[model samples]
Target: MTTPHNPLCPTHHGGRCPAPAPATLLFLHGMGATARSWDPVVRRLPATAHTLAYDQRGHGHSAFGRRPPTGLAQLGDDLARVLTHPSDCFPGPMVLVGHSAGGIAIMHCAATHPHLFGTRVTGAALISTTAGRLDPTCGLRAPAGPALARLFLHLTRSRTPVSSLLLHLMTTTRWPLYGRTAPRPTRRACSAMIRSTPPATLDALLRRLSTHDGPALTALTRVPVLIAVGADDRLTPRPHSRALAQLLPHAHLVEVAGAGHVLPLEAPDLLAHHLRRLLPPE
Candidate 1:
């Protein structure tokens, strides 16, 4: 299932290039995160690398649209569309890099559409994600669950006109990282990403997470897989990643010491190193 060469790719030198073009990297962000969250890691890739990152439905620049999707299928279907969408222009082998919910979406897509994975997807990295048993409570005590989380999301749907400081503080405090302190800018950026999500979208996603059984990932067994998790990640802790690795017995699992849920921002360098391993040698 070879994709036609993308003439516009930098490596396509008048159809006379000596080697096959590098796989285009497609990045998917987790819940409450925008494509912008990938900036740090994308920056670390080679200059000529082909990369694509976009806000998932109801996230960042993308809208929630008429009806909010009730299951992971919609998310997976959305990913399929992105891969095949003509305007996105990814006409070659791909390496999928998904964080958290993004990784879950990838699993659903691969399971539902094995044909697509068999052909174009050559590699994948599932980071800070889980296969099943996602605790949507997010470590909150009993009684302070999804409803309260939705309320918080509602409050942050828009920037507050008065006391914006307090709003930012509230958002930052909820960020699910471990003990190590993130740089001020990274913390602020992550907070802003979460704030951008509409409450409805967040609510729907939380519901989906709570009910979803793990997707059948047999299709992924054909590809090179890297499973990474923050050792101290509280949201989808290391045990979650261990379960995922057990399912994909051949996967390489890396536990980043002291890092947390925000692996893309928290440890971009380590991610960049592993992502390069999936790419063809230059």
Candidate 2:
């Protein structure tokens, strides 16, 4: 479907414009993160680039009234809406840039709606994410698995009040687990985003992450993709990124030494430099 001439503007101050109409760059943040997480990276982009970053449903400034769907495919749908919705602020070709869970969302969108990409999506950057869950071998175990499971069951089967209480605990209490290794500033930012999200959305989304098949690496062959990982990323290790890179026909893999999963904050300049190389000049 052709993207609308005008799209929904979710930012507090409408949307910022990139002078000279540079290619649109849509940034998707990791699970439990808000669009503000992209501030550092966005600031480094070429001044002429138009940009749009929104709280995905449950995350930032977006509507918290409805519970965000849990499945990755549903998240993909949300992304499609953002890109092609009639009232969306973004127009023309877009280069999708996603970090961690957001990267997975982008992959699902690209795979299911290849036509939407067309010539408009020049490339994609998947940072610190894997194609599938690593429950069995990744060594990073869910700390409160039992509590999480109980909360999930309650939310899915119980009343909104009970579920809401459980959700608050799950989202607020478990946020530290998600970014346990992130640096102090990054951790604070991530925590704030999670706290801002609705309990129902956080509960459902986390449950989805366990079973979500982010992207079938092999399916990315048609698009120009880049997979980068921190060499020391214990959560979604470097090996996972390597495995994903191997599946893409037109993919390039970059390993950032000593960098962890939070490369965007940990090494903004390095990440920006790579993005500059991947993005075409205006």
Candidate 3:
């Protein structure tokens, strides 16, 4: 199958200059993270592949996005904007890689713009994401789970001190890295990207996740999909991945052992290995 040239892509100068790489990959970072979070995985890919990663709204370099309610609808629009812009998109259909909330963002885009799946996107990798009902008490302790989930829910409305404390705890105390600590550079990169995001971003993300429509994700059925998760993941537990896999049998599901919520940082090479498999042969 021949992919139509982007026409506007600089390298697509007809018969005048050599066209750019045939395959393009776009990376979307998770909530409270910048595009830099995918650096580890991106770096491991072959240099010839066209790759792009950018800060999501209110995270890192991107703006706070006019205001808070940047829910799935707005995020879906944002993804479409990035993909259609001449400067943002590559010359070929894209293999979309997204993590955590970023995964939902990709799904939202696919859900709303089904046409893009065939014309602009080749495949998608949904990493550490959930479709809906994200408030499952998967990782918390048995007896106190409901209370903690309720507390987390109440704090989702941007109760500053609690929200800040919860985020701080999540970053420092929770299982950001599993089995062992990530490399120094990876740790530093994750810290810088995550720390730069404001409290309101996290608040809006939780609210959206809580209310997202699961049926919307059916739009992804039009293309090949990959669902990858960490074996020891507590946040979006492995079962979530399993359920999503069942939803799309055409999709592949992979669980990286000894990994947690942050697979991009925890196992960059491993994650990149999976990504490379989806690429077209050179």
Worst 10 residues of 3 by lDDT: 1-10
Q: Please give each candidate's TM-score.
A: 0.81, 0.76, 0.85
Q: Candidate 2: RMSD over Cα atoms?
A: 5.2
Best by lDDT: 1
Predicted structure 3: lDDT: 0.71
Stronger candidate by TM-score (2 vs 3):
3
What lDDT tens digits, residue by residue, belong to model 3 across residues 91-165?
677888989878888888987887888677888899987777665455667676788777666665555434474
- Clashing pairs for predicted structure model 2, backbone only: 7-87, 7-88, 7-89, 8-87, 8-88, 8-89
Best by TM-score: 3
Q: For model 2, what is the error of residue 80's alpha carbon versus the real structure, in angstroms, after optimal superposition? A: 1.5
Q: Which rank order by TM-score, best down to worst?
A: 3, 1, 2
Candidate 1 per-residue lDDT, tens place, 110-226, comes to: 988887775788899999998888665566775777765565444444443212433354365735553375677777788787777776677667656656788899999989999
172-208: candidate 2 lDDT, tens digit per residue = 5433233344556665665566666666665666556
